[model samples]
Target: MKYINKKIIFTFLLVLLMNGCLGIIPNKDSVTRKDTTTNIESSIYKKYNRHTDTTYYSHNNLFGKNISIYWTKKKKEKSYARIKFSYLGSRWIFFNEVTLVNAAGSRISFHIKSTDISTNVVSDRIVSEKANFLLSKVDIISLKKLFNSPSVDLRLSGKSHKDYALSESEIKSLFEILSYNP
Candidate 1:
């Protein structure tokens, strides 16, 4: 009978100790992860993956160099273009000049801009080059001119950079989908 009483006391104390410890332990799921990869000054890690189900565009022998592009809208609610390219010992913009020409002969140039997105890099290779070029709603509406024109052209050119062109067919195929993905 005495042995049974001691066992009961020990069990009660153990249970009480465990309950106290539970309150002191931190819960990982309750904590949110801070985003540090995005928003860097003059760094490749500034590009982050903002899109889901990315679509790729590439052409061989585009001015004697391989030119490629990946675009989508997922993480970034803003209208942006991320270019993963190699030119002039740089891993950012592949072309020095980019323009959109409408049938009315209106030529709109795209100025490369910095973004808060981040891309991981290791050693000397860019693992991910996700540069975000924000496109505002007003800007997209203006693009309607190029889309509705009889002939739309996406002309890209640069020194040491790959010069490439996207036909009307290519622009139409991606514009509607990439521009509006809610």
Candidate 2:
């Protein structure tokens, strides 16, 4: 009886070990086929001149206060691009200029100035502008990378300027705008 019981226990342990090993070894045939399908899709998207749409937002801590900025691709032209963006909150009062530029030396810029009431002390103005191809690609991933990259020496009256990462939703909206062929 003892020998029989031992045999049964040993068989159960062997079965359990085999099941565990099977779980760890992935079915290579299925994984390889799935990867092949994804590669083909990616290649197709690239071949068709398909541009993705994206939106990006960023924030900064300036003078102990938070200032938020956003950029979105609004439209595209045969030889140019159009983008819309906003500087949120009270800090908007300080901003004085905004611009967008491309490689062909085309530029579009906007400016504003706040009039001081009491002390007659005007703040160091705020300016926002897009330069280089980076501004043209305003998707979430690219925007995040842009903020992380080196500064482009954008300043307003000696005040340093910087960009921050945008939210996921903002990136999606920007992509939508860019993807519209019209």
Candidate 3:
């Protein structure tokens, strides 16, 4: 009888020790360490993906409207264009700019220097040599109007051209979508 009691007691103690080691009871104060290095690395990679090769713009009081835009190379032989209405100046004139991206991963930027209604100037210049075109006088006004219009489209010109043109409305819509998803 004594042997039977000892055997039962030994089994109970073993079960109890196994349950404790297995965390059957929640340890509220236990310092459970997690290896977050992988998660941190993934998050860092995701940040770059989030803003990869994209241009962003916001309200420019000079343009009298709010706008956003984005563009990327559409094909090996083609470039991308984006335009956005930044703001309307005090004179109720719209301000905006156009951004171009070529298949070679270059950005071409242009903006309005002056408008008929206001002296407020909105200007943009390519920060990199990857951009291979210059903004002409007519191109500036045309780009601004494009963004001002309700519809958006891209029209490419020039032989061996790296220049791209976009309207204001199109730019804004693209940025709006990007901002929403981001």
Candidate 4:
């Protein structure tokens, strides 16, 4: 009887110790990770994914509108900038032309290679449309050169044309986004 009690106690103690060790060890899934990367002076936000080895940079609320600029690059892929313009009207504006005018009055134009359109119906009478344009490598180089200036103006043209003068904040964010080597 004593032997049985001792065996039971010993088993209980062993199990408790094992559980204690498990509780002390941190779990891989439970470990908290920082979602956003460190901030730079330009307020450009970046997020990195360890699994895919990619980095994404984005800036929101550009041009006094809800426009957003995004840049992403994978480990072995070329980086590209995607500019999304939000239009409040219902008409479709398939923007295919992009022009950047620097503060020095020099202009660089780019024919958009990739374009996407998405529309959202807010109400029975109101609809919102978003158009996305991808900038090419040469356009990016021109943007890098124009980054030295104080501001840059952007123009998008399709069936119609719209002009946007980039604010100083927008220019700063673009400078940082274009300044990266990779």
Q: Which candidate is the best by TM-score?
A: 4
In order of TM-score, best first, we have 4, 1, 2, 3
lDDT of each: 0.39, 0.30, 0.32, 0.59
Q: lDDT tens digits, residues 1-182, model 1?
A: 99988877765554444323222332233211122122211111123343544332221111112222233443435334333332222244434455667668887676554353344552243232233354555655566445555466554443333343444433432343223323
The C-alpha RMSD in Å for every predicted model, in order, reads: 22.8, 21.6, 27.9, 19.6
TM-score for candidate 1, please give it: 0.38
For 42-132, candidate 3 gives per-residue lDDT tens digits of 1111112334544332222112222333333322333233433332211222323335442333444454444411323322211111112
Put the candidates in lDDT order, highest first.
4, 1, 3, 2
| Candidate 4 residue-wise lDDT at 17 | 42
Scored against the true structure, residue 30 in model 3 reaches a CA lDDT of 26
Model 4 C-alpha lDDT per residue in residues 42-92, reported as the tens digit of each score: 344678988988898774323324345678889789887876665554354
Model 1 is weakest, by summed lDDT over 10 consecutive residues, at 36-45
Off by over 4 Å in 2: 1-80, 92-163
Select the stronger candidate by lDDT from 3 and 4. 4
Better-scoring candidate (TM-score), 1 or 3: 1
Shift of residue 29 alpha carbon in model 1, Å: 48
Using all chains and alpha carbons, the TM-scores for the candidates as numbered come to 0.38, 0.24, 0.19, 0.55
